[model samples]
Target: MGNKLNQGWLYTDRINAKVVGQTVLDFYSQRYGHSDRQVWQERIELGQIAVDGKTVNPSYPLQAGQTLTYWRSPWAEPDVPLTLPVLYQDEDLWAIDKPVGLPVLPGGDFVYHTVLEQLKIQFPQESLFPLHRLGTGTSGLLLLGRSALGRRELSRQFRENLCRKIYRTLIGPCSLSEQFDCHQAIGKIPYPQLGYIYAATADGKSAHSYGRILARSPEKPGWK
Candidate 1:
C-alpha cells in the first residue's frame, strides 16, 4: 500500500454471545452493518480477519468472547501542509507551532508529510529529535531537541514530570468553577480508524489537568 496511513489492525474487539455459533463471515456481515456476505467472504479469503490471533477459514465457527482482529487497508488522508511556523529556535532546542490536522510523526497514510520528516528537510545539518508529540487534529507549540545532548536533557525532564505544558482549548458552556484540578488516570486503547485512543481508564497511569474558565461565550465574544 502506498503510504499506508492510519491503517493497521485498527479495528479489534472481542466477539460476544450474539455472534456465537455463526460463521465468521456471518458474524462480520452483521457486526459491520453490511449485509453483503460475499464482500466479507472475499476479505476472509485474503486472511484479513483473525480469530484469537490465528487466521481461520471464512466458515470458521464463531466463539463467544474470542478476540477478533482486522487489518484495515490503506486509505487516503488529507493533504495538510507539512511545514509549520518556527516559534523559537536555538542551537539546542526548537519550538514550532504545529498546525492542526498535521501529524507529528509518520502513521496512517502519512510518511514523508509528517513534522519529523519536514524538519529533517528544513534543518539538514543538526540532528532533530522530537521531545513530545501532539494529536494530528491538535494545533499547538511543539518542542524539539536539536542535538543528542539536548534530546537527552529534555527527554529526562518530561519522563520525570519536571516539564509542564499548558494548552488552550475552547468548549461549550459549562457550570464549572473558575479553577479546578482533575487528577485522573489516562491511557491509550485500540480504536478503529484513528489507530489508538486516549482516555481515562481504571488501569492507566496518573494524569492531571487543571482547568480555569477564561470567560463565558457571550462574555468573551469575538474570541477565536
Candidate 2:
C-alpha cells in the first residue's frame, strides 16, 4: 500500500468581528485564498466543516471565540494490518477476534482494507453480515451472522439488549471497589483533529457497565 499523505484538519480561530454575520461559505471565500465558493460549498456538503466541535450547516451563525475546523481529504489510503482470528464458526454464525487497526467497515480512507472485505474473501461461501461494529483502536470479539435467519435473530437480540458482552482491560489504580456498576451516558463530541465526532458525553443514551478488579499489578500502580 502507498503511504498516506492526504489526512488532517485545517483550523481557524474567530478572534475578530470581521465574520460576525457572514455565512460559512461567504466567510471562507473572503478569509481564505480560495475564491471559488463552489469548492467550499461542496466540502460543506461532504461534512467537512464544523463549528466549536459540532458539524453544522454552512449558514450556521458564527459566534466570536468559536473555533472552525475543516477536514482535508487524503491523497492516498494508509496501510493497515488485517489479521482476524476466528474463535467459533458454524452454519449460523462466526465469532471472530478482530485485530486492532482493521476497520469494521468502509469509512475515512479505508474501503477494501476492512474486516467486512476480509471476511468476504475468507468465507466466500457464506454470506456474512456484521452484527455490530467496534472502533479501529479496539481488538475484540465480533459476531458475524452467516445466513438470513441468523442475521435476523442476532439483530433482534441486539436490538432488545439481550446480548451481554464482557471486556477485559488494564487500567490505572482506581478508587472503585472490588466490584461496581457504572451508569454513564454516552454521546458524540467533536474529535480534536479528526473529521468526525466520537462517543463521549456527560449526559446521553443510558448505559450500564459492571467492572471487577481481577488483579492488581505488582510492579506498577495498576489493575486488570
Candidate 3:
C-alpha cells in the first residue's frame, strides 16, 4: 500500500491469514511478542524492508514459501545479536573465539553477521567443517569440524602443517638485523582477496616467512 505511513499485503495461501511467509518485522515481533531477532533488527533501521522487491538480508533465508514486505518502524533499535560464544563443542569438534569484526562465513557485505550464522544458531543439527581462515580482523584460534572423522582429522591438520601455529604480530619502529630473513615470493591477485610479499624476482610464487625477533623497539605502542 502506497505512501510511507505504510501498509501492503501478499502471501500465497491468500491474504490476511495473519501475515504469511513471515517478515514485516516478523509480523511486528509476532504481533508484539518480539524476538525473531526482535523483528530482524527492527526492520533493518526502518527503511521498512523489501524482499522479492529487493533489499533483503536480516539473515534472509526464508523460503519454504516466499513473499515479505514491510514498512513499520517508529524509531531506533539495532544491536540485535541474540547469542554466539562456544569456545569449544564436542561430538567431533567446534571451536570459537573469532571476535575482531567477525566473519567466518557469509561473504562480502557480511550476511547475517557471520561465523556461519553463529554456527547455525549452535549446530542446528549438523555440518560445520571450517578448517581455517582467520583474517576478518584477525583474532585467535578457530577450528571447527564435527564428525566424518572430525572432518578428516581437521583436514589432515590443516593440510599437513601439523597444526601448532602460533601468531602474535604487531611490530613496527624496527632497527633491523636481529637475525633477518624474509626470503619471499608470496602470491595471489586473481579473482581478488589480497596476498603479497615479493623478492624472488623473475616471477615469484614460493613464499617463505621465518623470523625470530622476540623483542625490541623504542617508540610508542612500542615492542618487547
Task: Give TM-scores for every candidate, taking all chains together and pairing residue i with residue i.
Answer: 0.62, 0.62, 0.24
Better of 2 and 3 by lDDT: 2
- Give candidate 2 misplaced runs (Cα > 4 Å): 2-74, 121-125, 192-198, 218-224
TM-score winner between candidates 1 and 3: 1
Q: What is the lDDT of residue 33 in candidate 3?
A: 37
For residues 1-224, could you state the per-residue lDDT of candidate 3 as single tens digits?
01222123222222254455565445445543323565556565554666656666554545534445654433221222424567878899888677665656543234345566657666688788578867656677688887889889888887787886666676777777766667676543222122122235535676556676777647535343
List where candidate 1 sits over 4 angstroms from the true fold.
1-75, 218-224
**lDDT for model 1:** 0.78
Could you give the C-alpha RMSD of every candidate to the true structure, in order shown? 7.4, 9.7, 18.6
Instruction: Give the Cα error of residue 20 in candidate 3, in Å.
Output: 58
CA lDDT of each candidate? 0.78, 0.74, 0.57
Total backbone clashes of candidate 1, pairs 3 or more residues apart or in separate chains: 4
* Candidate with the greatest lDDT versus the true structure: 1
Model 3: per-residue Cα lDDT at residue 119: 75
Spell out the clash pairs found in candidate 3. none
Pairs that collide in candidate 2 are 6-74, 6-75
